[model samples]
Structures are given as structure tokens and as C-alpha cells.
Target: MMRGLPAFFAVLLAALLVSPTSARAEGPLVLAAASLQDVMVALADDWAARGCERPVLSFAGTQAIARQAAAGAPADIFISADRQWMDYLQKGDHLQADSRHILARNRLVIVAGEDGAWLGDPAAFLNAVEGRPLAVADTESVPAGRYAKAALTKMGVWNRVEGDLARTENVRAALALVERGAAPYGIVYQTDARASKAVRIAGRFAPRAHAPIVYPAALLKTASHEDAAPFLDFLTSPRAQAIFRRYGFAPAANDR
Candidate 1:
């Protein structure tokens, strides 16, 4: 009877292993990025509904993503808000050399919470908010934070208010600090600010304040998916571009 039981269990295991649905369960295409969270989540859900495998995403500062991918994380794609970090990974031989492409552009804006003090003029804006905590991503790792610091410095206010700056891990974290009233103001991408109704945009920094904001996406060399090429094609499709536009990202220019 014990011998018969072993044979029955083996048959059951074989049946389960051979089941088409069980064998064909699709795994996710893992994506790493910070700014692409909202749009990517929506797109992934839509793609899933259309029979495409839903993508799993990990959002953080671009530097963090670069380090993880460089350390051999199982990331299928890496989308960075800046080219420098992507270049860093590429130079380290962590990315598929040919798969890189600029995917989108963004704008920088200063946002004040609904309950916060008003920022009238650019100069008065700095003065009125003196001594108050202002959130920004870590300048060392986040492009948005670096741009914010550059803009403030260009306006001759960065040094004056340097002590009031509250650094967060990423653009999203900076936005959260503002949204939750932990900080009265925050500097984040226009799209990041637009994603939250809790904050009102004080103003957009002039474009001359910093380099243009651009986003680049690429498939990593270590990606496990066989459909990586098709996925890249899907990312550049008009449908995906429209999704980016709806989320406040500008179309990638010819040079991007």
C-alpha cells in the first residue's frame, strides 16, 4: 500500500507539472525607475488586460537603480531620469549597449502645499519662506534635486536657504514630504507635482536654471526575457508616448 501511495503521488506531481496553465504562467518584466511609477503602473495594468504580462516595477533614485543593476539584480529594463547615471551603468558593462534610447523629457517646478505660505515673486518667494523646511531629493543622487539646487543657486538663493533644505531619498519622497505637510514646500518634476492634488505649484523655474530634463530607457544585458526587443518597441509606440504625455512628460526630441 505504501509503494502504491508513492506511485500515486508521483503521478499527481507529473500531472501538475504538465498542466499548460501552470507551466505557462508568465513572469513579469522587472523595471527599475523613480519617475516612471505612475505611468508605468497604468501601462502595465493595461498591458496585462490585453494578455501581455504585467511588468513588476521598483521605483527609487536613479543612482540606486544603477547600483542594483550593476550588482546583478534581476532587472529586465532600466529607465533613468538622467543620462549620466545610465552612462555610468553602460560604461560599467551593466546595460545592453545597443538597447539604450531617450524616452521622455520633464520640467522642474516648485510646489507649495495648499495650507502653506504663498510665494509671490521669485525673490519674495525665497524671503517669505525663510527658515521653513523645504524638501528636495538628495542632490547627489536625484536629478530633480540637482536641478532644483542649480535653479536656486542661479537665482542667488541657494546659499541663503541652504540650511532650510530637507533632503529626501528621491523625487517621490520629496513630494511625499510636501504632501504630508512634513515640509511646506518641495522641488520636484512638474509631472511629480501634478500627480498630487495636495500641493499647488508656486511656479516653474526658468529653463535656463539647469540642463534640460530627459529620461532614457534601456533593456539590460542580463535581462531574462526573450521578448526584450519587442518590449522596447512597445515602449516607443505612439500609445506609450501618449501615456507619457498624459502624465506631463514632453515628447522625446529628435536629438533625445
Candidate 2:
């Protein structure tokens, strides 16, 4: 009986070793910017539907995720809300240079819960919004906030409204502040306002309001998942780009 037990264990080990790779592989872990919540989730589901391992999505502010990458966090992919953070990771040697791709571009907009229309320039909008706390992401560390600050500064209203700002950790949270009436207005990505039924885009910043809003995706240098490269490629595929377009993202080529 003891002799037979050894043979049986050996056969089981061999069977396990020869099993299909898909059975043994886990989904890639994707650390993406918060503004990508809707589209990324949809794409992950689509990827899984094609019999691939569903990617695990982690969303946060660009700075937050960039800091995690810098700390050597074990994620297969990193997608930033802007080029600055992507450049930060690339500069730190945390990203695979060849794997980097500009996924999409976006526009910034001011959102509000109210239904009234304001047909005025950005300066007039700021003047109308005076005294009320305007919700925005952390202007110093977050990409969305930084863009909002740049746009407001361009409109020459940053100094006037800086004192009445309601800052949140991320753009989604800022949106929530407006939704719940914590603030009458919030500044967020165009995609964000589109995703939420609670708010409507009150105004859109001019293209030159701030630096271009670009989303760049890349595999991490420490990525070991078998599906990492494929998933990253899938992000730019026709199907994926279609999904992005449906969610208000511009093509990567538009950035250049």
C-alpha cells in the first residue's frame, strides 16, 4: 500500500504540471486613474467575455497610483490620467518603455446638479459661482485638480475662488460632493459627468484652458502575469477603442 501511494502522488503532480495554462493563470492587476472607472470596468468585462482572465482593476488618483508604482507595488499595469505621472514612472524605471502606449485623451468640464443654463464665458461662470464652495480634487497632487486649477487660472479666477474651494481626494469624490449638494458645483473630467445621472455638465473648459488631458497605459517592469502584455494590447484594440469612444474619450492619435 505504501509503495502504491508514492506512485499515485507522482501521477497527480504530473497531471497538475500539464494542466492548461489558463487554468493556472490569474488576471492581470491594473492600477488605473479614478476617472476611468466606467470604461475600464466595461472593458475588463469584455475581456473576460472573450475567455481571457478578467483583469483586476484598481482605481485611484494618478499621483496615488504613481506613488504605489514607485514603491514597487506588484501590479501588472498602470494607466495614468495624464502624461506627467506616466513620465514620472518611466523616469523612475518602473515601467516597460516599449510597452508604453497613449490610450486616449479627455476634456475638462465644470459640473453642477442644478438644471439652469448659464451661457457665459468661464470668467462669468466663476463669477456666478462665487461664494459657493466649488468641489474639486486636490489641485496640488491630483491630475484632475491640477487641470482644474490651470483652467481657472487661465480664466483669471483662481485667486478669487481659491478660498471657497472644496477639495476632495479624487475627481469622483468631488462629483459626489456636488451630487449630494455638499457643493453646488464641481470640476471633473467630461467622462465623469457623463457617467453620473446626478449631475450635468454646466460648462466645458476651452482646449487651451490647461495642458492636454492624456491617458497613457503601460506594463510595470515587475509585472509577471502571463496576461499582462495581452491585456495592455487589448486596451488599444478596435473593440476597446470603441468602448472608450462610447465613454467620451478621444483617440490617442488626437493628442499628437
Candidate 3:
């Protein structure tokens, strides 16, 4: 009798382990820009608890993501940090015109290591520091780099400071240079500066320094998931917008 009771409970426990409710749970779908990692992960957790599948995030540069999608990666969506990359995919016929949408906006900020001195003015940013190197993204491919270059050029300091520039592959990498003290100052998005405690904002460049920064999200033409529609809807939902705003992203103009 004792053996039979133990056997019965074991069978019941096995049945509970394989319950149909547990079997029906699904994982999330995601392909996101590296800069969006912190907020996106939180958003995904909130979504998963609401019966949405947990998102599988793939983080990389927006340009890299666009190229991967164009090359036939099995991504359900692409969240680009800029429109140019998304437009690149669209121009290549890799994304459906109707699937594209501008997601958010960001502001550029000049940041220095926590121990570094403040840059009192934008003009001072152009001069060479005896020991500190200036870091920037590579203007050829990274949107942030290109924007920074344009802004510096507008300020008429590009040529003067170009010699001191330490070009990085991406914005995050540029930020890293400053954070690690490899470079004394870096141009990065405000949100990125906020992400690291090792960095401090020395000053904000005038808005006229560069064109407005915008981030775009889209469903690729080759996305395989039918559930992508719901996922995209969640992204633009108020909850997601709130998350972005909390992370320092501006409300997209098209949100109206």
C-alpha cells in the first residue's frame, strides 16, 4: 500500500509537469538595435507575462541588422537606430514599404569620464588635450558618427579636430572609449550616456549642430512569423512608448 501511494503521487507529479497550460507557452520574437537593449529587455519581460511569448532579442548595429535582413536572416522585425539603414533595406527591396515606421528620436550629448573636467563650451571641444584623445564613431557607416561629423563641421571645427579623432565602429564603441578613459570625450546619444555610471555629460551641443535624430522600426518583407503584427503593435503601444520615454527617447513625431 505504501509503495502504491508513492507511485500514484509520482504519476500525478509527472502529469502536472507536462500540463497543457505549460505546453502552450511560447517564446518572444525580436531583432533590435544594440542601443535599445536595456529598455527592450524590460519591455519584453512585461509582454511575456501578459501571455505574449518572451522575445528573443538580437542586438547589433542598425546597419548590420539591415544587412542581415537583406541577406535573408530569419528575423521577424528590424529596429534601426536611423532611417537611412532601414531605407537602405527598402531601397534594396528587402523590406515592404508598408511595414516601415519611425519609432523614436534621440539627442546627442558630449560625454567625458566621471573624473574628467567639464567642457565649458563647444568651441573648447575642438582643441587638443595633452593626454586625452577624442573618440567618435566612424562616419562612413555608423549613423551616430556621420551625425557627429556633420555637427562638428557645422561648428567649423571638423578640420581642426579631425587629427585627434579616434574612430570607432559604432556609437557604443565610441562611448566605451570615453568610459574606459581610452579617450577623454565622446559624442553619443543622451540615453547611452545615461546608461553608464562611468561617464558624465560635459555639455549638450546646440540642437543645430546636427540634423534631428530619429529611430525607425520595421517588419522585413521576408519575416516568417505571422505573429509579427501583434509584436509590432505592442512596440508602438503606450506601454512601450512609456518605456522609451523613461529611457530618454523622445516621442516620435508620428505618434500623434
Q: Which rank order by TM-score, best down to worst?
A: 2, 1, 3
lDDT of 2 at 92: 91
User: Which one is best on TM-score?
Assistant: 2
Candidate lDDT values, in order: 0.77, 0.85, 0.74
Q: What is the TM-score of each candidate against the true structure?
A: 0.85, 0.87, 0.84
> Mind sharing the TM-score for model 3?
0.84
Cand. 2 Cα-lDDT:
0.85
Clashing residue pairs, backbone N/CA/C < 3 A, model 1: none
Error of 2 at 105 (Å): 1.0
What are the runs in model 3 whose C-alpha is more than 4 Å off?
Answer: 1-29, 128-132
Residue-level lDDT of model 1, residues 207-242, one tens digit each, is 888988888888888787765666666778888888
Per-residue alpha-carbon lDDT of model 2 for 1-256, expressed as tens digits?
6866665565334323322442444688788899998999899889999999877677778898787777666778999998889989988999986888889899998888876355258656866688989999999999999999999999888988899999998999999998998888889999999999999988889979899899989999979889999999899899999999999998886331
Q: lDDT of candidate 1?
A: 0.77
Q: What is the lDDT of residue 141 in candidate 1?
A: 74
